[model samples]
Target: MRYLEVTVPKGRRRAVLDVLDDEGIDYVVSDETSGRGFAAVVRFPLPTRAVEPVLDRLNRAGISDDTRVVVIDAETVISQEFDDLLDQHSHGGTKGSRTSRQVLRTKAEELTPAFPIYVTMLLISAVVATAGLLADSPAVVVGSMVIAPLIGPALAANVGIVTGDDGLTSTGFTYQATGLAIVVGASIGLAVLARLAGLEPAGVDIVVVAELQERVSPNVLSLAVALGAGVAGILSLTRGFSEAIVGVMIAAALIPPAAAVGITVAWGMYGAAIGAAVLVIVNVLSINFAALTTLWIAGYRPQGLFEVSPTRKPTYAYATIFGVALLVLAAPLVGVTLVEFQATQLKSAADEEVDAVLAEPEYNHLEVESTEVLLDDDYPLRSVDRVVVTVSSSDPGPMPALTDHLHEGITTHADGPVVVEVRFVVAEDREGDASEQIVHTSSGDRDS
Candidate 1:
């Protein structure tokens, strides 16, 4: 429910009162003592869903487009007429339960913050994320996401489009593009500084660090995160869910991948950098597409009759562009997913072949120890390059036949040519290897 305070302009008082009366609303009108253009102040309580309809009625009654009106949440209403009003609006079901466009726009603007603060905060977050990635700390990385002011622009653009607010639409896109650039730039700057200071270390492979690797080689699961964040973002905006919690989720999709772009750039890993950059772009497009589709389908549009056609046509065109671009960018992710599946399959087949070879009676004395898999260094798109198997034997004699047998078996199921190596370790029998001592019992040599 809402409580609206309307400033009824002089000579429009009767029209405004009549508009309220025809709708069976209960209002209290008091004279405006101030010598302003307004003659009286009218306050009325309404169900949340009825706000738009009543405002539209006021607009149609010759109230100027610039008329001042304020709508706020109503905690309690004690009128019999208010019960009837709530019942009247409840018939439309859940769709009518969403916050009005005006409230949504206001909330989005509030979330965005001033321009300078937005850029500064994002730069700080990027630096923190880059440091976290280098240090290989998951908790610190998540801390970076918590402080990101990203959700505002993520959802604001869609709200602007659906509500016919051009200013908001422009600001939302501008902020998103500019803010992302800022974060990525900050990460690069910090990473470059770290590298120059020798903090990257002489023997470290920074790009393949556990934390950084997650973003550089994104797959289908990455796309799913962005889409989910977007859906949750818009739903929170319209339905009063916590935007702060969802902001972290949205940042999770964008922040680390952006940081990956910087870390790779600093390390001169352009191949991996391109992969990470592509992931960031795909996630952004997916988020925007999801939010726009959900908002439009939820019946969010300009309430004015004349504004709907002009707004929706371009709005839908942009939506289509987002959809099409997502399809184009996401094609690579699908390819990456297939490669990953192939790699997993190859590993499984290699293990199976290793077991089959040692199962032979000639090699029965050898105990298989461990198998290691080495994959190619192709960014995002990777394939198995080599497999190493180690075995223990009581005899020291070399066996050249085992390597050939294992290679032939694995290569049959492999998608590409691969190298196989076998290493032998000699293990002599030793006494008292077990931790506990055993003694023969009187009955049947039972352990004591």
Candidate 2:
């Protein structure tokens, strides 16, 4: 149950009271109170189900402007007469009541924070994400998600656009863009500092840590995750559910990828950085698009009829822009996916070929340890698979023959031209009284 205290102009009090009476709502009206400007106060108790309808009626009756309506939660209403009244209204279910537009507007306004808090949270989230990526810790990454403030402005952007509030739209966009910039820039600065301190992941190769790698190569699947998060986020907001879980979902699509971009940029891996940057862009657009669609379906619209027609053109334009961007982003993702698939196939074939070659009588003592198909940087566009085989052998005599046979087998089974390289480790058997022991030592790579 909700207790509403409404103050309206003195002349309109009777009309408002009549509407309340028609709705079967019990109320008490106090007229011309004190220093107020000819105002009357009408206090009423209403069932949750009737709140939206009552408010809508009052709004249409011109009681919304300047008139004050404050809703207070009724903990306990005890009276024999009121109990009967409540029982009569209880037949209509109150679950999932639609929130008033005024409430939603207030919510949007509250979420649009002052600049300092927004930038601070963005920087903190970015630093946390960077540290998580460096440590390859998912827990730390999720911690970052929990603190991320990006989802607010993202949803706000959708809300503003849908409501045709230019000020809200501009504020949302400005905050969102500024937050993203701070996150990326701060992450890059941290990465540079880490590198300068020799704290970066050891080696010149691109940081292939689990967190970084996962975000650096986003595909169609990533977009889907972002879109789903966006929908879930708006649903949570409108339903008055916990926003924390939904915030995590949005952060999952956003934070790590942005961190990846910064880390890659700091490391000077521009190609990988491009992929990470694309992932961030795709996720942001996908979230906004999904939220906009969800809000529209949820019956959210601009304030006035005049505003409705004007909103449509900009809505379509934004939707089209997002659609085209998604299509363009998919192109590189598709290429990356195809290349990865081909690499997997080539690796499998190479493994089988190496096993067969090592199974030969002359190379019987050799054991295949591992096989990997890596992209040859020299001919990346051509999709040349470099088959690297690591083998342990007791005899060195058959190594040459083994390499040739492995190369022949791999070249035949692989889809494209494959460059076969064999790495040999000599295993020496030592005779012992207690037990037989073997020692393996690397002899280095032998190209075939």
Candidate closest to the true structure, highest lDDT:
1
TM-scores, in order shown? 0.90, 0.83
* Residue 181 displacement in candidate 1 (angstroms): 1.1
How many residue pairs clash in each candidate at the backbone level?
Answer: 0, 0
Record all residue pairs in model 1 with backbone atoms less than 3 Å apart, i.e. clashing.
none
Q: lDDT per residue, candidate 1, 1-448, as tens digits?
A: 7899998889999999999999999999999988888889999999887887788888777666677889888889999999888887886554355777778889889888899999989998999999999888899999999999999998998889888888998999999999889988998899999988888743356766788876887788888999999999999988888999999999999999998898888888887888899999999999999999988887788867898899899789889999999999888788888877887787788789888888888878878788776666788666677766777776665565676677677778777677776667765457523221112111111222
Off by over 4 Å in 1: 92-96, 201-204, 394-398, 423-448
Worst-scoring 10-residue span by lDDT in model 1 = 436-445
Q: For residue 257, give model 2's deviation from the true position in Å.
A: 1.8
lDDT of residue 198 for candidate 1: 88
